[model samples]
Target: METNLNNQISEEWTVSEDAIGQRIDQYLSHKFPEQSRATIQQWIKQGYVKIDGNDTKSKFLLKGFEKIHVELVLQDRTEHLPQEMPLDICYEDEHLLILNKPVGLVVHPGSGNPDNTLLNGLLAYSSEQKKLVRAGIVHRLDKDTSGLMVVAKDGETQQRLIDLLKEHDIKREYVAIVRGQLSHTGHVDQPIGRHPTQRVRMAVHHKGKPAITHYQPLRVFKHFSLMKLNLETGRTHQIRVHMHHLGHPLVGDPLYGNPNRIAADVVSELKDLVRAFPRQALHARQLEFIHPITQQPISIKIGLPEDMEQLLEDIEYYDDLDTFDDQMDVEYVE
Candidate 1:
């Protein structure tokens, strides 16, 4: 291993006879246990890894006595500094933590949001998270979409959780209020990708990654329905995009939902309330997985946040009123 003034690291390795026929990325993962295989693959794709003075693919088969070289530019960690903030911890152990993330909290730092994100808060909450990638965040929720999230406290646990997600071993359930009434349970098996023109939004496209969401109606209202949703595959803005694709975009989804979709007969007050909803009416309601360290099954369920609860209550009230009015009209005609 060698390091220069620019903080770039260069390392070399010689393949042994016993390790013949191993994939380069797999071999590198074994050598650097702390780094993820995905990261190593990215390094290989970027021409940072070479075999026998030739750039190689991550899947390159290794032969005995081949010289491998790797160079990586270290990322400066100072940019993501710790910021003290409140955390809604649902469950915590030495290996992992289950958090109930609230609405309006950014999960990570990005272009406009350079600090004061969940990552920064995690850094303040646990110094050990600094050593883990993305502060041990295996998956993510959109800033306005609040719900449960699992965070690992160590590298091995992080890798295990990531693997569980990849294998769909983790069970995640969500609750949402959508713009249209649904009478039956259904599932959306579609693909989702970044919008062609709208860079900030996601859309259902044929060329996108495979995505699936199963949904059941909990309560059907005049113009809205409360839904129970489970993710078969976690894609970016997946539920929102799929629901939108079905023409029942989630209530209060600023990007994909249309306020005009509300039923004209819906009481004026309810219409105003629905239109004024501040964020997507979606929440991660449950999470279930096997504990990496304890080898135990873990399941957690949480109720709706205050705003969603209030909105649901209002919808129920107005829907019942509409029903009563219709009953009265029929009786009068009789």
Candidate 2:
């Protein structure tokens, strides 16, 4: 482990993008062509590089045309710390990538899941710079929600994707088995923020930012309903919060829903399928966004998991299926 005092590297560049606003780490990645991500992460951790002298969020918006300054510091070792992990890569190209994130895989490390997160998997997968953490994580899916996600390989493309998400230009939709038989179609518009008494849970609070979830009920069983939900604003726990606020928390949600709420009739019919459906019954079913480099629309669809599929089969077997059609069009509008 050798170290060096080449701890300061300085550069200045002007933002050329109108959409590339606040995500400074990503912006500078494009601006500083020769500098690698390993150097950027080191700079970020050392408080050397900043946007307008203020440290900014990785997901923060970028306002283009700002004259930015950067300072970089080199890590002690530039060698790759490699760990072997398998990934189910869906699509891959020079600028963009897509992966099928499995359930129980934490997207990034936190309190309980400090090691072996999706980020760690990405680190092992990255054949690029050795020390950068923000290699290509453009967005994230909750640990329990299994499905497809897109990642950016470089800084310019990453900023464009982030900007698209912020502007609601991108589209993301989810499917989940939640409690109760909800209306055929409805939208929940509520502001979600951290709970006052319990920090872990989210609630509809006046101080929280605006959150909207449009749901179309697809099927109904004795008690539970399967619905497709579309997000308007990307916020933490937005779908779950909005659903719970509507008195229909997702089935098997340990954190927010009534765990024992599965009605006897529903449970009796789902005896075999119940064990398979363990976690919160949510899956990111579809994703659509513009290709930043190609400027063409890309849409990908993932079918439901075996558990969800089995659960629905049982629902149909138990009674005359009063399920609503799943053939409706969903589009995002302001």
Candidate 3:
């Protein structure tokens, strides 16, 4: 290993007989366990790695006893500025923070949204969190999906939390209003892929990754149902895609649901209420995970936001009316 006085670290590795026919990226990935193989491949592609003093590609096949040199510089990710904003913190400790993110709050800065995000707010909240990448965000909730998310206070905690998520050790439950009545507990086990033609949507395809959603009907209404959902895997838009595949897309889901047709299913008085819904009626209602630092368990539960609560009330009212009409019809027949 060699070290420069500046912020870069340069190291050398000798390929053993066992590593003879491996690709350069694979060899380096084995050498450095902490860094992701994708990161290492990016570094190699950018000419940060050399085999026998010559710049080589990631797929360069190695022979035994070849000397490989690597130069690494910690990534600088402070391009985004911090902004002062209010946060709905659920729990906080030295290692992590659990918070309820409200609707319309983007989790991170993206192409259209360059600032004023949860990441920006977290940066302004604490200096330690500011230094970490993406404000130490471990997982993400869609901008319209309001609910619990955990943020790490440091890098180690962030990695551990990520590992825990990959292991499926973290538990997440959601509450959503979906179209049609579902009376029984259900599970959706399907593969999800990007839409073939519709780029913004996800669909079920054989080539896609495995995704599962478990849901139980909390309340069956006239045209819509309140559901309690548990996720076995957290793929992008997993619940939305699975529900849509089941022919019962989430209420108010503009991308995958029949938002426009929702008004037609309800009565004349409730059409306006259905049409006025802003976003998907999905909320991360509960989150349970083991603490990375404290080695303790944590569980959090949040109630439905006011808009969803109002929507449920409307569903119940219409459902009651539907039941009454059925009863009246039965009496008339008798």
lDDT of each: 0.86, 0.72, 0.83
> Which pairs clash in the backbone of model 2?
21-62, 21-63, 22-61, 22-62, 22-63
Query: Whole-model lDDT for model 3 versus the true structure?
Result: 0.83
RMSD of each: 6.9, 7.7, 6.9
Of the two candidates 1 and 2, the one with more favorable TM-score, higher being better, is 1
Q: What TM-score does prediction 1 earn?
A: 0.78
Rank by lDDT (best first)? 1, 3, 2
Q: Could you give candidate 2's per-residue lDDT for residues 1-334 as a string of tens digits?
A: 1224564556666667865654666665655543555555556666766667676554557777666566655442323234567888888888778888888898766798767777667767875423333556767888888888887766567667877888887788898878777746889889999999999888899999999889987666556678888988988888888888888998778777866665666545464455346788888888898898898788888888776676666665763346544454422111
- The candidate that achieves the highest lDDT relative to the unseen native structure: 1
The residue-by-residue lDDT of candidate 1 on 1-334, one tens digit each, is 6868775879998889988999999988888766778878988999999899999898889888999888888554335798999999999999999999999999999999899899999999987788688899999999999999999987778999988999999999999999876757889999999999999999999999999999887776677878888998999999999999998999989889875567778889988999899999999989998897799999989989999999988888777434433322121100
lDDT assessment of candidate 2: 0.72
lDDT of 3 by residue, 74-185 (tens): 5644567778998999999888999999999999999899999999998889866754667789889999999999998866688789989999899999998898867678
In model 1, the Cα lDDT at residue 76 comes to: 42
Better model by lDDT: candidate 2 vs candidate 3: 3
Q: Model 1: residues >4 Å from true position, as ranges?
A: 1-78, 321-334
